[model samples]
Target: MFDSLAEKLQATLSDVRSRGTLTEDDVNAAMREIRLALLEADVNFKVVKRFTNAVKERALGSDVIGQLNPGQQVVKIVNDELAELMGGESAELRFSSSPPTVILMAGLQGSGKTTATAKLARLLREQNRSSVAVAACDVYRPAAVEQLITVGARAGADVYERGTDADPVEIAKWARERAEREGKDVLIVDTAGRLHVDENLMKELAEIKRVTNPTNVLLVVDAMTGQDAVNVAEQFAEVVQFDGVVMSKLDGDARGGAALSVKSVTGKPILFASTGEKLDQFERFHPDRMAQRILGMGDVMTLIEKAESQFDETQAKELERKIRKSEFGLDDFLDQLRQVRRLGPLQSLLGMMPGLGGHQLRNLRVDEREFDRIQAIILSMTAEERRNPDIIKGSRRIRIARGSGTNVQAVKALIRQFGQMQRLMKSMQSGKMPDIGALMRQAR
Candidate 1:
């Protein structure tokens, strides 16, 4: 997630912000450090040069030098230039006028093309489209068709696959026809990938394109490849003439050069970013939010949007009422946990909040085993016990703990923590809570 680059940039900005007034030399020194950081992050040389120049010009402009908070002004300039370095705005998927908008997925081997196909289908499903089908045209790899079928099934989409003997182009044509007959609104063609850019791959993809008449040709680039990703995108664009780019593996230790330089280098906007292996790990690329992330400022708007998308309003309101009344029981806590899980991993969601990035939540690993333990404990509770915890005497607590495969003390500690959290929420709602800083200290 560009952790190294983010650290470097945050340190550089902190130094600049510490200075009450910034002279030309101070700005130059800061820009020099930023240039080094970008280069160390493996950014393209041309992009680095252009970015440094734009940032320097903006920092030295009268608007910044004359501002009351020159440090904030300089950070603002860098953020703006960073956003511009990526696409200035998030790009939309281009749909054709006809039914079955064909989308061709292209990438090198191991770029997660097959998985990205299902992620895209899930994304389209969220848009209220029906009957999204994926066509597996990768006949070279023996298990490629089955792999896509498994992913498509996980995404709740139909998958069309032909055996290795079938020509990929023919499979694509047939898949599209089947989608149309089945009344599918979109058909994604997962084409073959090469170990390296080759003429054979390009020729096959071109034939598939000709047969399917794809509305959008998306090039999936691995963000971990850094500047090499830019070169790959350029080569694919030349051959496939793709409409947009999909940057995958962004949740890994990607230096982020690909995301910043791909669109600028290839003249194609980034349509989506694949953050993880999960089917719901895809997000539309947002230039502004990405700018905030690069600058160590979290993406609050994107975080809120994700919450809104996954949260059931009625359940949320009910929980809110319980919290206000100090009646937040284990059932409500479990419900809240499920809602948060839908928004993605706990650490990732927390990292999107302001001042909560960096190593703030590093020690709190949200592993599946921990979630299972919590669920087991909750399930061990009787219906009456969950509704009214005060009725659970020591014997009942021990019994529940034994049922959940946990010790008695662990069960007692969870009950205490839940009670504290409920009381804290009630106090906050009533405007009687202490400052968050003090509460955090007490929690620690």
Candidate 2:
């Protein structure tokens, strides 16, 4: 998600890791490059200065300067400082002792506030919050209430809307009463957003706050806005005073200045991030894991979490059994492919694995469209052909290609790749990949 910044920072850290020992001058030079990298990534100047100074002070301290692995020590210091700069630990939503803890969503009009409200509801559903209800208080924007209802429905949360004609504050109060009467555990108020923070906007938000008595007020910030987002958060804090930030569109080409600077600049933690447009693509922010990913170390914990959430244990076990027995067919393969697709973008998945540098990722040129193509090809085949791909010769390949609206060569290539994958699966029975030379030959 921190694509540009991660690229620059990973390259800088990779050099440090390659060096056996580091002199003070060496560290200073690296720090200068790091400073420039952060600045180029659009990180705040003040935040960058403070972050570099902290890293330098720790790197030059007794523990690291005389250490046997001084370079590694300095890298560790940077990772720690990066984590500290972006909120040391994850901040979760705090619920009230009373039932129906209210969460008020606030942000600029184009910052993806309503969508984030639905994403939050979806996350709460995963957290065992079944009795969640969303109230649409955004009366200003055209079809704003309808937008919230649609997304809220996708998130599996009941949406309360009194139409766009009703006053937003009364809509909020009415929804609160409805959720309380219905014994809901949580109520999220999607407040209206303005083009910019103004007295009128703040006044309406303040009135909603007074009526709803929200336990948590979350400002959805577009991470792609960079410095302007930090400024918006500061303005909101001065007026409405939100409890945390929900940084949306992390999957975009965001330089990541706001995420690093928001909490430090506005005294509010970033509670969650929306990595993709999917309703289920929301996640709680983890500074340490993000720092690891930024340094090209990968984030296996998040990978595992995605797997746990998307993969069905029974189905996964059956698929594993089929692979072990060499019974994995196009049907099983299609099922597995769909499951992997549920885990979000393929490039993002690969980036989470250890040692996959940004350069390698870029070089891979992994096409997400490949999944759709494979699915189409597999679906075009008959039951027998799918069960036993070996029998699919020239005529069958042509037929499948036409059915899938693809060329014969495309179908042939897919079959060839599938055969290679099956062979690799069979060889993995020994818990190790086949010899590199043999594997390369098979790949060819």
Candidate 3:
């Protein structure tokens, strides 16, 4: 998300960490570069100033200067202050004690409020509260209500949509009532957005708020909007007094300035970040993990969480048993591939690994097409041949190659790689944890 900024910050911190001692002059010089990086990343000027000042004050304090590994201590200070600037802790969605907790979604045109609404419903469903109702109040756009309906269907939630003829306030009120009657636990009202901030939009939103009496007002901001996002958030907060901010499009090459500045600018915590268009791509915000990501240290906790979510414990244990017995086959290999794919794109997964970003993986493109080819090759093998690859003689290899529509050499390469991977898995199963850095070095 903040790839460029992360790279720059990592380099700057590495340089500082390499030094034996840190002086005020050294800290000032580093802060100057960091300030420029933040400005270039489109962080709000005021937020950047405050952030740098906080970092500077802490860096020059007695705890850091002339201490052992002063450079590292200073970097730690920066990370801590950056996390504090964004909000020291994650904010949880506050459910009303009364039935049908109303959540008002507000944002500008194309800010992904509707999609986030569905994503939020899906998140709530994961918590075992499945009765979610989406109220579409965006009557300005012709298909806005329909879009919300479709999203609601995808999220397995009920939709409270009124036609274009109804006033938004009335629609919201009716939707709330319907949710209460239906025994829904939560009501999400997707409000309309304007091309630009104006009196009419604010008045309409205010009217909706008056009618719905939402328990939480969330401002959805596009991370790609950079510094301008802060102003938009502030404007919305002034009118609606939003409880929190949702930063969308963290999967893009967003410099992350909006994410860094929004909380400080709006005086609200960032509750969630939407990484992609997929329903499950949204993640709850964590200040410490975000701090690690911003410093290019890799978010190990988030990575582990993602892995745990995607990896099946039973399947993993079965695979371990197969590897221990030296019975790992092409079928197992295919299963592993699917598990890795489920985690996320291969590049993103690798990028989260320590020391595995930027040029380190410049040539590895693990797209669906590559997976398709591998799967086709595996599918062409007979069950017996897959179980015991040694049984595949020259004639069998030719038949398999023809079936897969690949050349003989490609088939041979796949077989060779599969054998090596099986051996590696066996070694790992035997308690030999391979050094990932060495593996990358070998790949290079």
Candidate 4:
């Protein structure tokens, strides 16, 4: 997820921010470092040149050169330019006024187009509450249709796939009609892709577009392909008029090239990003938030949004009540842990926190196995022990350890941590701040 680029940029910015005032030479030096970072990240050379020039012009302007905390001003300018370069604002999928808004999905073979189709369907269904139905028109690929069916079902979208024999155009047209007749809110047509951009691919896509008259035409590009993905998007732009891009494999160690360059190169914003393999991992791309994340400024808005989506009001209120009454036990803790796990990887969540981005995030190895061990240890405990951990003694500790396949020390550490958390909660409930220094001493 732009780890290399983020590290280099954050390091360069860290140095810039340390300076009290920035001279022309200082700005040039920082810009040179940034140029190198972007180039190394495989960003388009033209885009890199344009972006650097813009940042330099802004940094050298009168507003920043002699200003208080000039270095901070320079960093702000870079963040702004980076966000602007990545399409300033997030793009939204257009829906038709009529029923069954048609969305045509296009891409080259192995671009994760099929998977992205299902992911987008799931997102629209969950976020927009749309009755989504995905049409499997990728007949050329062997298992493309079946794959769409499997993933689409998991996404809770109706699959309107006419197996591999039917013409993709006909399937798309038929699927749209069916969706309209069935009163579906959306119909996503997943078109066939080729090994390379060929006449047949464009021709078939054009025919499908003509038939479906989609409200949106989304090009799914593999973000991990770096410059090649941008090139592919450029080619697609030349042949078909896509409304936006769906960047797949964004969770991979993508050098941050395609995601940064696609909008600039193809004149299309990336509407969605497929961050992981799971259908639910897809999310709308927000250029500002991404720029902030890359710059080591946490994206709290996105973090909060994730929490809101996973934890409903009733559950949150119940948890708060339990905490206030000192009734939050191992079972409540387990449930909370599971809810957080659903938000995504812990490392990713941490990366969204301010001061924990880039190198800091890379340095922290958040062992997901620890979570598994915690779950196992809690499950191994009796209901009574979970309700009141204080009841466990010497013999009970050893038995619980063996049952959980863990060591006594591990169980002890977990209980200690939980106790500290409870103490902190109790302090808050009593309208007093806990003694953090004392707690640190106790933990040690």
Candidate 5:
């Protein structure tokens, strides 16, 4: 979503970093470029101005102007200011000392409030090891209760609903009581939302808050709405209190203005981001890491965290042993591939690698179906053929290709690539660096 903005900012920073010296004009030029980039990204005008001023002030300060590497200092200043503008650090969800921490979810009707509720419930259950229950207090929209019932179950959280017949406030109150009785670790109240921020919406939300006395009130904002999302958050801040923000639809084609400007406009930190449609794609937002990504510096920590979540330590050790023994068969390869795919889309994962952010990432197109095709080819192979690829003669290869819905050439290419990979692994196991250029030539 930040692709356009990221490209412009990264280009500006690249120019700044190429210089050996610095001038006030240079800093001003960079700030102007940044201001334009943010404006083009639909950022709040006031936020853009404030952010640029901060970056410019620091870039012109004595700490940077006469520094040994002034340009690098300026880049650092921009990165720091950007992080500060979003939120200096990641915000943690406040849990009650008592059982059943209540989290009140508020947002506009189309802001993905109900979906965010389920996603947040799943996140808390996994990360906090909490037994979560979600209250279906959104009785206004058609099928709201049923929607919660379906998604809430998928999230592995108990759904508390009195159906659309019950008052939202009463449902919230009862949910709190039930969660307490059941000794649940958390209870997320999914409240009703309006097409816009209106009096009825605020009043109902206030009533729900009054009844539930939630530990944390989270306002869900659609990142796709850009500046309008920031405006809605500001309006909510004036009438009702919310602890933090959840920026949803973060993977959309929106300019990312909402996620960048909400904290600055409303003084509420973004606690979570819904990056994809899947419930598991939701994650805690880290401002510093986001800032680095925007600046074309890869987020290695987030990459590692995602990898650690998907890869099993014991399985990793076994896989290593298999590679060392030249026993890494196609079955093992398929297992490893499945695990990597579980870490999210291959393109997004590559974007987290060092030196592949910004323009480089924009140009890369990862065909996910290639994974499916590879899996199909591997699955078509018999157990003996998978274990011993040398026995896959011309006729065998033809049969496998036919079974896998591919041509014979595709099958042969895959086998050749696997052979090259095995040779590379053998070299690594023997305490020698593989000849990558030679291996690539062999695969071709």
Candidate 6:
């Protein structure tokens, strides 16, 4: 999501890295560019000034200026400062020694708190919190309780709602009691939000906090709101004193101002972030990994984690066997596509890939509907036709194209792409990385 800033910072730092030696003036110039980039990306003014100053001091310090790779040292200093600016380490939700660890969700209207609550539950489930429960206390908004229940079901967490008519605080208390009685490991309370920060909203949330005595209060902030999100978080922090923030819609936020400024402005860590709309799209925020990503160094650890969680091991082994035997087909290609989709958006994955950012990422736009078309074309074919794509000649291609609502040319392109993928895998097996330069020349 730090697309613009990442691009600018990478370019500015790449110049420094190219130099064999560094002068103080060179470091100053780079820091100037970084400061501008952060401002352009809407990072908080005070935070930007402090961050740039820290980075400049480290960049021009004797330790870095005397180093064999002074330029690299400067880059490392920036990376370290970025991590520290964002709280340095990952912050996990603190649970109590007692049962039913309460997590109070707080945010403004249109902040996507309801959805973040569900995503948090799903994340907890991944961490072995099997008996997670959620209390839908957002009784002010219409259908808020029902929305929580629906999303809560998808997250595999039991939802307790005393209907919209009941007092939110009382409902939260009752839900906590019920969760404790039922032996739920965690109870997440979805609190109501208003269009603006108001006394009534604060009072309601404070009352809920007083009644439940939540272990963690997470403020859900929409990353797309940019600096406004930081302002809202600052106000919320003063009133409700949240433990951390959950940044939702980060995938859609190209500027990433909220993420970069939240910790600095509110003095709270970003505990979690929602990368997409899917329930599984949320994840624990790791500042170090995020700093790496923002600096165009890539987040290989996060990428590997996503792979370990979403990629099928048995299917991967089978696919390897198929590639070695030249048995990989359109069926396997489709399966691979689906598995990749499970890892979230393709563009987000590309950002996590080493040496792929800035202009390269901007040039590549992942169209999910293309996968639909490919699936349709494959499904329109017979079993034999899919097993052996060579048999699909002129008339067969036309028939498949019409059936799949695509042109015959599109069918031909799919086959060609599939063949290229098979060859690419075979090259990989030979311990050689096949270059996709030609394929990537086309933006589509």
Clash counts per candidate, in order, are: 0, 0, 0, 0, 0, 0
Show where candidate 6 strays beyond 4 Å.
64-68, 299-444
Off by over 4 Å in 3: 64-68, 298-444
Taking every candidate in turn, the Cα RMSD to the unseen true structure, in Å, is 11.8, 12.1, 11.3, 11.6, 11.7, 12.2
The C-alpha stretches of model 5 lying farther than 4 A from their native spots are 64-68, 299-444
Residue-level lDDT tens digits of model 1 in 1-444: 988889999899767754556899999999899999998888888889999999988888846321124665677678878988888877888887778888899999999899899999988988766569999999999999889989999988889987788989899999999988988899999988899999999889888999999999999999988888889999888787899999999998458888888878999988899999999999999887888898875543344456546554565566567777777778877765565556655555543332333244343444545555666777899988888777877899899989999877667766666667666777664312112222222322
Check candidate 5 and list the clashing pairs: none
lDDT values of the candidates? Answer: 0.78, 0.79, 0.79, 0.82, 0.82, 0.81
Q: State the lDDT of candidate 6 residue by residue for 105-177, as single tens digits.
A: 9999989999998988988888865689999998888789989999999999999998999999899889989
lDDT of 5 by residue, 1-444 (tens): 699999999899877765666789998999999999999999899999999988888888746321124665677778888899889989999989998899999999878889999999999889889999999998877699999999999999999999888888899999999999999999999988888899998999999999999999999999988888999999999999999999999999457799999999999999999988899989899998888888876543344456646455566567667888998878887876676667676665554332233244455566677777888988999999999988998899999999999878778877887787787787564322122223223323
TM-score of each predicted structure versus truth: 0.67, 0.67, 0.67, 0.68, 0.68, 0.68
Please give, for residues 1-444, the per-residue lDDT of candidate 2 as tens digits. Answer: 677788887788767755655778888888999999888878889999999999988888846321124555676778888889889988888898886889999999889888888988988888865678999998887788889889999999999998889999899889888988998889999988888899998999999998888999999999989899999999999988789999998888457888888888898999999888889888999988778878765543344456546554566566667878988888877876676667676665543332333344444655677677778988999999998999999899889989988888778777777787788788664322112222122223
Task: Kindly indicate the candidate among 1 and 3 with the higher lDDT.
Answer: 3
Q: What is the lDDT of residue 330 in candidate 6?
A: 71
CA displacement after TM-score superposition, residue 212 of candidate 6 (Å): 0.5
When sorted by lDDT, best at the front, the candidate numbers are 5, 4, 6, 2, 3, 1
> Which residue pairs in candidate 1 have backbone atoms (N, alpha carbon, C) closer than 3 angstroms, thus clashing?
none
For model 6, what is the C-alpha lDDT against the true structure? 0.81
- What ranges in model 4 sit over 4 Å off? 64-68, 299-444
Task: Give candidate 3's error at residue 158 in angstroms.
Answer: 0.3
